[model samples]
Target: MASSTTRPDVETAAPSARVAGRLLDSSAKLSYDPLTEVDWETPLDTDFHGASPEWSTLYGTSYWDELTEAQRKELTRHEAASVASTGIWFEMILQQLILRDVYAKDPGDDAVQWALTEIADECRHSIMFARGAKKLGAPAYRPRRVAVELGRAFKTLAFGEAAYAAILVAEEVLDVMQRDWMRDERVVPFVRTINNIHVVEESRHMKFARDETRKNLAKAGPVRRHIHAFVIAVAAYVIVTSMVNKGVYANAGLDPERALAAARSNEHHKAMMRSSCSGLMDFLASARLLTKPALAFYKRAHLI
Candidate 1:
């Protein structure tokens, strides 16, 4: 009986093992040390934008057209810094989640090893984002108080598919914007390098997250699935909304009230978000995590 079960166990573990092993190999081949890779010694250049203008929250708003070129660049720089600050916050949350998820698991498993490697990558990323934000001459941009408390709660309680799926949503949203910023000549060189490093490494993390989400959900009953789906959707809404802080408008020398109103109604920015997240939305739908309740949250976040 034991012998008969051996093959089934091996078959079941093979896919996860293979994925983790490949990710480990990939990390070894192309991982970066941002400490040395980013040109930290160079003086910050005011001429370069911190991000692509089109990704700006106010990009298509009437207020955006009134800004001078320097003002526009300044605005984007602060916005980029705000985004990076939010990234640091979420990365901290995710590191704890991953650590918690792997606690008491077999240390020798490839999946466990891969999770640790991913944690190491995220630690470095948080540091890199902090430095980058400072270099952009932006102040610390923390999430709103409600979001902070919610993230604290989520990081403590989320597990399995709920945890992994939330991680995927954050990575996917940042991935799309960073992909554009990394290639745009208008973005500062060091910032571009940072984006490139993050994009390269986070790709593997996203793959692992997607795999983990599917695997975990496979074991969940219908009730659990629907419950986690709503949880993950709420998490996504918080993350997406927290990306650009409200203070960025004032920091960029814009009228905060006017900028906020314009940004709230910016159809172009909403469209960009929906377009960028289409693939992620499809993945959630395929996993059957896009319940009617979940879809409503995603729609409100402009991620659908």
Candidate 2:
């Protein structure tokens, strides 16, 4: 997170304690261990997709129409693996941002304890996603270099609502996409289990993020709030763009340049993002973070 002076949300106690207590108790009762819980022993099923087909970046492109069923399945599998890899990257950033947010605070406090718990969950989740991608037969996928560098800086410097709201946006985007894959029968069983675990565990994280964003904004002055809002939007844009690595198309055996072009012009995929993130947009609007400059970034990212 940024300098300690910028983090007013951590200085509070009553509301933070209530939220953190519930989260900690809930996690104890319902959290999963992906190592034992996921059905990883089964052979990879070529008949199934790694995620819902509609979530694929090239789902409605002309190239999609040209692909055979096997080709389409292969593409979605690579796409899913790419998404999982991106999840791992973002989770790493989130863990660091959060750990920084709680640094030197009261370790015994429920809020700090819950932050630690959330970090543990993300650690397990990154492992699960890595295993899932390997099982799907995709090579390691990483975000673009620019995104990688920006994430390093953001995790190191972002504080208050900027960090929390960016966290919320990433969680909400993954939550919606994973919800579909978890429930879709066409998705591989092991991958479905991974998505299910993430969706469930991240629910508490999202709740905490939303609460923290509001609390931070409550203390922020007009100038600071406006600045963080734009920063949050830029972070969201980078995250959204980085979700699918460019290597996926080529790894899936498609023409890399052509597939990339098609995916870029994919109105259907953009519409899906906009539709899925409606509630997230509502939350940002309610928080008054959707300023004109911020909304421009959101629109350019097709997350409006």
Candidate 3:
């Protein structure tokens, strides 16, 4: 009775988009709230410990001075980049604080307690980066209007935890990237001090991300939920990556294209990317967060 087609005629169904909508809805809860957890009352006496004079020698003070005014301008731009990067980190912490509030609503039995500790570390990092920028003679960075708009937009979403998770992925991946960059660069004492402080603290935060995300995924059973988490994670990564491509580099007066080129080709930068981002991908993959679809998505996004 079967012609060559013995197999039943099958209709391929379109993937359900409910998960995608839920992920976006979850992401809409992030209103950029002012961080209130930091103890501003504590003195920052150590913040002013200036970088050593020997540091100037590394960049060759005389040669550095001789660079065209444009090159000098580039340093200003780089400092601004530092601030923007740290600002993203700060926003992530703010998201975490909100997430903590949400997670508290239905706390996981094995939720990581270290989130509180990482919050303290992030606050210190925000201060350190801001101070570092000021020391380098860059103006203090105020949050951009877009940050406010996005925050307000997200705040309209009712599903807060999903929104927070989206932010978690965004912040954690960037921190992982920064930690790698700091390790590779051999700067003078002052900049080195800043990097040293951030790297040490960020390492723990990265580990915490691994553990916490693992727990979150473990609790997710439905294929739709997993897809939802993946979409949010992808969105978070996009937001962070876009920050670098947008005004962060250009505002500092550096040629964004050239600087990106330098960052990509620089041996130290490459090393850091490998150590930090590469390791993060591996960890997530090992933990089964990076399934075939996820890996394919990252590859398409140029993240892998």
Candidate 4:
């Protein structure tokens, strides 16, 4: 009787174990040490934009048109730094969530091992972002006070699908933008290198998050699904809004009041977000996490 039960348990765990094993192998084959991979010694080049100009928050605004080429480059550099800072914040949250998730689990399990591996990646990523921001000559751009408090609560209390789904949302959103910037010749070399590293490593993390989300949701009831859906949506909203800090405008020598107003109503920026995030929205819909309430939040965030 004991052998029969144990056999069934092992069979049920096979798929995720295989996925985790593959991820481990992939990391071993092609992982980056950002400290070495990035050109940290090179001074910031003012001639190149920090990101693709099309990904800028004020890209199509009248204010954008009015800026000189140098001003536009400055703005984009600050914007990119702000985005990297926000990535650090979200990565920290996900790291805590993952650690709490695997706590006391079987150390030998491939999934738990993979979880630890991912945490290590995030630790390196946070340090990389901090150094990159300093190189760009930007101040530490933290999320708003409300967002900080909310993230603290969510990271502490969220579990299973809520935690994994939220992690997926943040990764997916950043993935789209980074993919563009990494390939654009107009972007600075070092920043492009940073994006390339992030894009490669985060692909694996996104895959794990997607698999864990579906696995966890399969065990959830309708009520729990609905609750988690809303929680994940709120988390997405906060993450999206916090990406480019308002302080970036001032740092870039733009009038904060005018830049903020223009950015808030930038139709081009909204369209870019919606188009870029279509794949993520489809994944959420397929997983049945795109409930009406969730859709509303996504729309408000311009991610739908």
Candidate 5:
């Protein structure tokens, strides 16, 4: 009977649903448990960097040039922890958005099931990031009050293409850096493992988000499209700005004001961000989400 059943809905399902089916299969084969995969028992190795030095915010700045090798390593470690902390913040927002989207949807649908699976993966990631930060000997780092409140509101209210595109932006920004860190020998082994796990899992999330974004945009009128395009850009700016917390500078034994200024204007970091996000910008343009209003924030964030 099951074999005889002709499901017209499956035949008519959007491309997004088809992609979700493939992702479900891929995940069943290659998903990770960060808790068991990461080496948690090893003590923090001061000799190793938490992330690749080239990914550092102040990597090529004058101040960074003056810092001793030990200070440089220490700063990178704190920066890495701050990034992880910021990631947890965004992951919470994303989980809520996905859960809201899937609420009351058919539980048996492959797309809905994949969404639930992504949420579970994020839950594991948040725990993994928390433990990783603790083991790095860094305190909890968070975004500014304004950013946190804005994120809360966005997660609660954003829907359709707006929500999925914003999710794609955050994941894309993190994915580029993680790819570099995962392969670099200078990075701590456990951190590399964490990055590797995140990279593999998030590839699925990004693919799903991209598909959903395009699918949702198909239903949007010009007015709605422009509004959500701007919203996604603002969200991008917030997420990118929050990647490394200001408190990390002081905690890393640098002058907070000077370090913050340097990082804000760091040419190397800006170039890195731009280079890494070029493909994402192309995707956004292809989706016609790169309205003039959105371009301003993209330029400001150096993600264009």
Candidate 6:
């Protein structure tokens, strides 16, 4: 009788398995599609075409425009590399968040939705970079993925909440940077297009990161014992400093070490860096994680 009963239970399992398969399929549906969602065909306004002679006066458009065709092409080539790197960074950020959410075992549906949106954005950005390279007749090179070393570093060094906050601040800074470059008369149209797409999406991303970070910090125990938050904050500082160094200036054929030195020497970059770093620190202090010791450490590191 027991053996006979087992066959009926097995028969019952088949229908349940079918139902589970359908649920999995439904859940796999993508929340966003980059091709349909982005305004790829949007026309560039005339300013990007270097049409106005006076435009050369307000900005150093003459210096940019006076480059020989070959030089202009080389700049485009380098810009594409820069864009490729930016896209890779965005993809890494998305993957890191996904891994964190999984590890925390508190992955909400909302978080998954956000991840999917970011993935779509990253994919679109990758395509845009590739397209720019193609248009410029430059060899398309994929941005190297986050290395094993980086993963190991995160495992050992990361603080969840602080890292998230840093990401928020860095995104805010980059959003401003992209907006400025996109509106520059000397910037090429394709470059402006890439920047415009990023600016549109990242504005929302930055706001979400900031708002959600505050909400998360408020719910955290007032005691500053959270290891995750600490790691995140440190990661943010490392990344932001790296952005000006390896990320931006390096791609422009400028020496990053020298650029850092130059930024220290120049009032503008130094002032911008200081103000931005201050904003990041203020947020951490508000969350009670940026102790006097931490602030002093940042100052010593020249991160402030």
The numbered model that scores best in lDDT is: 1
lDDT for 83 in candidate 1 is: 97
lDDT of 5 by residue, 226-304 (tens): 9999999999999999989888888889988998899988999999999999989999999999999999999999997
Weakest 10 consecutive residues of candidate 2 by summed lDDT: 1-10
TM-score: model 1 vs. ground truth: 0.96
Q: Determine which window of 10 residues in candidate 5 has minimal summed lDDT.
A: 1-10
Candidate 3 segments exceeding 4 Å error = 1-73, 76-80, 83-113, 139-186, 243-245, 248-275, 291-297
Quick one: RMSD of model 4? 5.2
lDDT tens per residue, model 1, 1-304: 0121222233456898878877877787788999999999999999999999999999998899999999999999999999999999999999999999999999988899999999999999999999999999999999999999999999999999999999999999999999999999999999999999999999999999999999999899999999999999999999999999999999998999999999999999999999999999999999999999999999999998
Candidate 3, residues 1-304, lDDT tens digits: the string is 1123312211221122222222222223321111332223433333221222121111333344454644544453444344445464445546455454446543321222234444555666666566655555455544456654554555444133245445455555556544433444332234444555555554444444444455555666667555754654454444544433334345545466655555444444334333445655665556555656666656544456
Candidate 1: residue pairs that collide:
none
Model 5: number of clashes? 0
User: lDDT values of the candidates?
Assistant: 0.95, 0.93, 0.45, 0.93, 0.92, 0.49
CA lDDT, candidate 3, residue 257: 68
Q: After superposition, how far is residue 132 of candidate 1 from its true place, in Å?
A: 0.1
- Candidate 3 yields a Cα-based lDDT of 0.45
Cα lDDT tens digits for candidate 6, 193-272: 66676776665555555655665676677454355455554554454444422333344344556544544455444445
Per-candidate TM equals 0.96, 0.95, 0.55, 0.95, 0.95, 0.59
The root-mean-square deviation over C-alpha atoms between each candidate and the true structure, in angstroms, is: 5.2, 5.6, 15.5, 5.2, 3.6, 11.5
Native-structure RMSD, model 3: 15.5
Q: Give the Å shift of residue 95 in candidate 4.
A: 0.4
Ranking of all predicted structures according to lDDT, beginning with the best and ending with the worst: 1, 4, 2, 5, 6, 3
- Show model 6 residue runs off by greater than 4 Å: 1-80, 83-87, 102-108, 127-152, 155-159, 222-230, 244-264, 275-282, 296-303
Model 2, span 1-304: residue lDDT tens: 1122323343365877888877877787788999999988998989998889999999988899999888888989999999899999999999999999999999988889999999999999999999999999999999999999999999999999999999999999999999999999999899999999999999999999999999999999999999999999999999999989888888889999999999999999999999989999999999999999999999999999
Q: Report how far off residue 298 is in candidate 5 (Å).
A: 0.9
Order the candidates by TM-score, highest first — what do you get?
Answer: 1, 4, 5, 2, 6, 3
The clash numbers for all candidates, in the given order, read 0, 0, 3, 0, 0, 11
The parts of candidate 4 lying over 4 Å away from their true place are 1-13
